[model samples]
Target: MDINLEMINLIKGEFDIHVLIELPQTMLHANIFDLNANLNEYDSLTSFWPVAGKWQLEYLEEYFSGCESVHFVIYKPGSKLDLIKTTYKVLKFINKHKFDYLQFDDFSARQAFLLPFLKLNKRLILSIHDPIPHGGEFEWKRSVIKKMFYGKAKAFITYSSFSKDLLRKTLGLDKQVVNLNLLPYTVFRKFLTHHTVEQERGYISFVGRLSQYKGIDLFIEALPTILKEFPDQKFMIAGRPAFGYAVDSSKLANMASSVSVMERHLSNQEIVDVISKSKLIVCPYLEATQSGVVMTAYALGCPVLVTNTGGLAESVLDNYTGMVAKAISSDAIAAKILDFLKLNLYQDMHAHITGDQLVSKLSSSNLETLSQIYI
Candidate 1:
């Protein structure tokens, strides 16, 4: 669901982009994405699966198609023997092809092995959305290892200047960094128009995966104070847990009686419906680079109340596009929510962040900047 449909639309015409994904052989159980849907725009699609044994391979051959080259490389999940095999297979594949450029959206332990293949660093473009680590030294050490291991890339791209600056200051990256400012994610535009009922409008929402760094806990903690002001107001927490984090549904019981919890991963249509039903989307992140949730809110013309950390504040124009918290504390978040409601800022913001406005802003400028990387 994080696939930027807007970015896909922008680059599909000019770029022959291939998608490399790690998935099970049969996508029947895949919840995060549908490999077959909306893939006609891609040049090729390759999946790395765990034990693509004889039967699984046959199932993949039959179930998956439309990709120019439907290929699979086997890698057993959570097993050292298979990880080594997968690494070697992936390295061999990389060695065989010569790409014009490579853009890394993330750099983690899973990708650490591929860093050494960066002999031609100039053809590599590092896209660091969250440049600084959430924790202290451990993350910093990992980042340094990544930078030194990969060496310097030809260029860097980020969603906001705040993240780009963080990359420069924290990682000492001096490459040509470009900010593809505020690209609209209209993946659910049609869905919103169809499924969103006008009568369902008006609840304060926290949309996206519930992670500690995302500060959904802070938003939950702030709910008591928020409800004191608007007794009839309902607060909806709509999203599943992020990777290793579990959102304890039991805690919702102890909280205010009006808090609605949608603790499952929502589809694109469901996400649009939740966002559309809300008067304001709140992101109480303790740290962030850029928020796709905020962008999604903007795309739907829904105003946001975000914490003033990292690029969250930068994403909003403060009182114009959205409101930012005074601080990251529970008290600060509650105060901002109440204050935002008092001012009645949604109508003004909704008028400003229109689909046409985002399209105009996302057009030639972003396209030119991204096209330059290919050049």
Candidate 2:
């Protein structure tokens, strides 16, 4: 999304920090010429190109002109033309205005390649998001550190402490590592509101990318046992398969007669609606780092049942915000779900922990920490 004036105002007013966000397209088309002067032509195939280019250029100009401590959050990597253009634009801007820092979220991408171009600017933040399981223990870490060292990153940011620990202890780069939690504001504003009270629903919900590691099969396996005790209970699984992962719809369908599966990407509002409407949100992940889904459940005041893997427990206090099951076992997940069902603590806990209060606390902490870094 383009950084609007409202977002600019919010950053300036709330945190007293001036941010100049380089538009994505300006970086994308950095060196590509208007090859045919057909940049304005609405060709069915390439119509999106020029429009995106113009939009990004406009946003970049406005942002660079307005703010002093300019920061560019690069979303794409290794588009040579884009990288060259971005490097040129940034160099010119830095020479003209003296930018304090150039930050990148995906450090492994073009950031590494573009570092030599910006070697004059000593301030660079190279971040990484390890969203999947890395099987090799020490060897994988050594390689990651080697990459970071080559990248010349001043600061390194990651989503979880597990990965951070790999960078810190194994690579001995603790001084450079920073932990930045993912925000769930999109889900919060979409599904959660103070006005909505608890509603009774017969089914339990799971929303996220449907994959083997996500343990949807395990949830399916536990259904029969859960059905034995509570005959009326139903299971709802939402979200599509991860990109390039094989998804067997018939296999999922065969698991249970009462299962309701929505195999498509749900909008933020739809996700909130489903979670808010359900009795509980179940995260039966085989592995995870930190979960944006768990945070969404918490912010929506939906009681959660998560596995004791990764950073799931970090956000969920046992028997407080939600319940944590034993690691990677269907029976354990089932037991926790049954326990939460038996206790019926959904309403009481929901009333106790205010969503706005939690959101404000997280938002404030993030802003405070980020402000210190920016300054």
Candidate 3:
């Protein structure tokens, strides 16, 4: 469905909004992180840099049709000389152009190291998705360099309240902070509108690259108890594990009849295929912040059962959309999972989850907020 949502409100001011994203071959069709990729900031006008890639025109016409305001200047530079060359190209381009406001959309390796030291005259803003690296993935040098990166931005935007608060305490700045909710990844909208999965809804899944803070092992541990009651209940674990972490093939092998694991990178259509068929998505995080996975589940009209850590609990409206585990233990997770199934909450949640309003509202709110601050 190429549903072109007409925004109810246009930002009050008139300025060219330029969003910068320099990463390794990331797609506007893949995520909501490239927020401006599909959303318009101005009520009736849209503008793009002369150098905008012709390849992106298809995505714009299909998903971003009739939208106004922000235009993304995405430049992905290669290693060594190419990196230096493209860095200068981007900087020079910025100096040469006249965007009323420019925002670095997210943290990228090259941007973090080079952006702070550059001498550009334009107003700059940064949106930090992860204020700190997850528990086991931290490094001292990255932290030091990241602090310098934090110092350059004139304003900050975060999707999670937890990250906004932590960034303040960690960086000691509070003014010009904007907190907005993450929008559902709409890359799946077309697939969902056309095809429907044939499987009866019983699968409960853990999606996303398996990482230490993600608590995949805890989710596995809680499974036996859930299986004891709903003996035929299905379980699916998707996505490749991060470095130094592994999912035991043998551990899940015992319950082979009921478990399905896809340990590799998943395409956008494949993700929609799984979440759309499943009744519940699980995010058993042991630590905090926000989740894009939870947002995807909402898009598919599938409810989630998340651990009561970070922004996971805050993201789910318990008893309606989904439920949060009382504690971060296997037993607590199982208990909530059981409650959701026993009460037959899936039917009501599935019916209520059709995501059109939620998606449009998130965009509308963020655009309005940005208009106020960027002025």
Candidate 4:
């Protein structure tokens, strides 16, 4: 680890402000990235971001105008020795000045181990994105870590009412829980296209990190039926696979002319090109708790269809910004996709979702409204 004693002294002087520590490579990073983009100056908030987000944050940092940040280097989760070493290094680094509060943008095992050593009077706040583990996550371990954080946190934030309700009703949360909508990932705006809804040229697409919980199989199951009805329609699957996929691509193997599959992760420009020009994107998740992908599609003025699971439907207004499938089954997904096409709803959503109108309604943080809570 490189130590910059002079840099530490400078940032240390800037402490005693609210510090939002965000986990890397997750929606939490995207959330802070979006909020930071809208900030006019370095006010009460000082944040810690991972080096992984440097690709986008570096571009934003120029106008960020000394809104101070500590970009910590982190090892990908799964190493206990590294977590222990990193925790101690962090303890020695910033334990000198007590902060106004530490808003944990997300929780992690490393934080669980470090919490007891912090004898400071700083208030602790946590944001809960998913109440439970997804398909292949280590439920026992993550649940233990979350339980520890839940007990220590003074307040909690949830991106959707559904998640808040679950924490209160299911987990029996005794802490004050505030619900807030996650801001759109404005970091992607740098690559946004000028494609209008009427001028869109991309085909039906699925864009996200693929996993079993995402239910990509359900959509693929319904595709043949869809292809039969509209053989000329092209479909693109653009995401890298993770945690073992539930679907078999062989079913779509013969439909090369109609379907295009890219089983790797997409770069920012690639994401923009695919989503900005898309006719509509479908999210066939078996379960979900809000979605950055839904918000990203809206940011790009693309229509979306989501299954009625968790907080996914909360991301869009049914039939207005986007539509929702009646059920999680293939038949339901196919029927809704058919409805969207036959009614021409896909071509009608741009005016409702583009520009500041949609951003103000959906993405605005209402800093004033939130000021009372953060403090």
Candidate 5:
């Protein structure tokens, strides 16, 4: 919500800031990607490029209430033909507007291909959320692919210092890098502040898109052991599965009655409600860059249990803001959960996570740093 705060501070009138979205309409509708499935609503500061249809355009117009400009450029999926279509549209827009700088939050192969063809008088900045993609890959191939996309940019932006170090090491770059600790999903603050689920403090919830790497199956495998001791403790799994992954109902069938699963897209409000009601949020990812889920949990004044992988553990302060699993193993994850629940670390974690000092640093100073980087 950097742009929103910028507007609130009367900074938008000082500099021309525009939002461009090269939306893959086909995939957006098909829900092929992790984040695209829930695009029915826009929660960010910048307005959406309504490439889907006029109705979406209208919705975005209303959604981006304080922003002035909202433009749309549509293309097919991420095939070769789709690249050509998207490049053509992007080129036309760049030529017409003639912006001084173009910043891309997506440093994918598709964007890398389209970068060379963008005939514009603009300095390109590649905002690398995950400097190195999560999971192990051949070092040479990883380096090659990263340099292919990132090498084309004039500068780079990383959301966390951990990502910046990883990017520098991966790309072997000496270029200018801007780092911000956490990116707040501040729009939820308004709604989340007004409403809380008022749930009874018992269920341990795992929320977010389900996938193999996300460790939902690991969570499940750990369930039997957890239920052995705290049989009354409920485990709730919320949110839709990752694009093509299946929810093996068989896994849940023979489990204790304390397990509850809701396998569908949850609305923004629904997510806030679930998190608000949760006694603890579990993110047992095998790998990750940064977690918006952890930030959300903090915003809702709920503690988290995250595996010590990538930037996931960086988002948490271990025994303070939340507990971290020592390893990705199910045994490790189960043990950590039991420790948090049984040891009664919630009050301290809640205090630390929702404290005024940390909250201001994450939301105010962190966001201001981001806005300054754009200029």
Candidate 6:
């Protein structure tokens, strides 16, 4: 149950913050929180597993004791009773400690479930991370503002300008909303290790879920044309497949030998390694809300070739950091890849955003802004 002192110190040193709330172990790798873990054999679906809960509670209590202000970041949906109970237990403990801020990631669900406790605390920050508009006219923004109105929190935070615009234009709540984009810390470090820039590795790498919307099938379909031009070029596919959208890897491999698929969950370190070694990271998503992968790729100085859909466009400046292909089309993806290969600007772009530069840009200052919202 012991907390990592080094990690705590690192966070404190970077942000000049005393305490941060850590959720119980349940939410860390919980099946409900992450759909990618559903198919894994090691995933435990049962709620309130005695050992994990006990250890997590003990660890979190110790961690909270050391910090000045503990901000709890909750990301679970409202359906699970066990999650609710666990959250309540944490909240009660935080109440006793008189923590500085209580932050909830899902505005509506958190407001609904934690309304009783949150109503008493005027320091609560109800936040949302809706990357794409839910229905038409950014229904998610309206829903969030409604939640904020009901919850009566100190402030609200969101991730993108699209959502921020919807909040301002549709809801007329611009002053109440804050936009803090995702930081690519992992990718930034990889770029620093290489002393001399080598020739482009010349492979298309896709690092995310293998679901239908992820455009894995599109990448598979385009393999024939891609391989025809560069027979020796390889295609690396990392990350576990999403729930309910499974793929037959054996059949997929037989169809395209050039396509090297790592059909397993990769650790954060492994992800950085794969991205750093690649020529380009292909995010061929048919539809995306917000992209963590795009930011990760840019952080690693690995140019991205993404589709012109959703937040992918927002993340990758087309023909700048990377190219944007037509959505849901393999031919378009292949064309973009071909176009990218033809260009000789990889090193120039890589030099522009060094690891230290990215780290400084996405450093403690960003987290400080987030802290302001919570405080």
lDDT of 6 by residue, 1-48 (tens): 011232243355444343433343354542112223222222112222
- Which ten-residue region of model 4 has the weakest summed lDDT? 1-10
Question: Which one wins by TM-score: 3 or 6?
Answer: 3
Task: Encode model 1's per-residue lDDT on 61-172: one tens digit a residue.
Answer: 2222333233443334456765666667666666667667766666556557666664564888776666765532135557666675336577877888788877776544
On the 0 to 100 scale, the lDDT of residue 188 in model 5 is: 50
Model 6 score (lDDT): 0.58
TM-score of each: 0.75, 0.70, 0.81, 0.78, 0.75, 0.66
Look at candidate 3 and tell me the lDDT of residue 272.
79
Clashing pairs in 5: none
The top-ranked prediction according to TM-score is: 3
In TM-score terms, candidate 5 sits at 0.75
lDDT winner between candidates 1 and 5: 1
lDDT score of residue 349 within candidate 1:
82
Candidate 1: the clashing residue pairs are none
lDDT for model 1, please. Answer: 0.68
Segments of candidate 6 deviating more than 4 angstroms:
1-89, 96-100, 107-114, 119-122, 131-154, 166-175, 187-202, 248-255, 326-328, 355-375
Worst 10 residues of 2 by lDDT: 31-40
Query: Against the hidden true structure, what lDDT does model 4 obtain?
Result: 0.67
Kindly give the number of clashing pairs for every candidate. 0, 0, 3, 0, 0, 2
Q: lDDT by residue for model 3 over 1-375, one digit each (tens)?
A: 111111112332233333333433345443322222422222112244332343333433333333343343344323465556556666666666655555665555666646754564536666777888897888787677666656766788787888888778766544467786666655555455345555566789998877888998888998899999999899999986776777877778778898899987676567778887789999999986888788778867889888888766767878778888889999998998899889988988776667466556767777777676677
Predicted model with the maximum lDDT: 1
Question: Number of clashing pairs, model 4?
Answer: 0
lDDT of 4 by residue, 1-375 (tens): 001121122234443332334333233233223322322222222244433254345544332334454534343345567556667766655565455666676777657777888763537777678877777755677778887887777777777777878878654545677777655565566665565324555588899888988988888888888878877878888887877663476788888788888887676667777887688889999988888888778767788989999888887888888889999999998898888777877657866776566556542353333455656
Model 5 residue 321 lDDT score: 86
RMSD of each: 6.3, 7.4, 6.1, 7.7, 5.7, 7.6
What are the lDDT scores of the predictions, listed in order? 0.68, 0.59, 0.67, 0.67, 0.67, 0.58
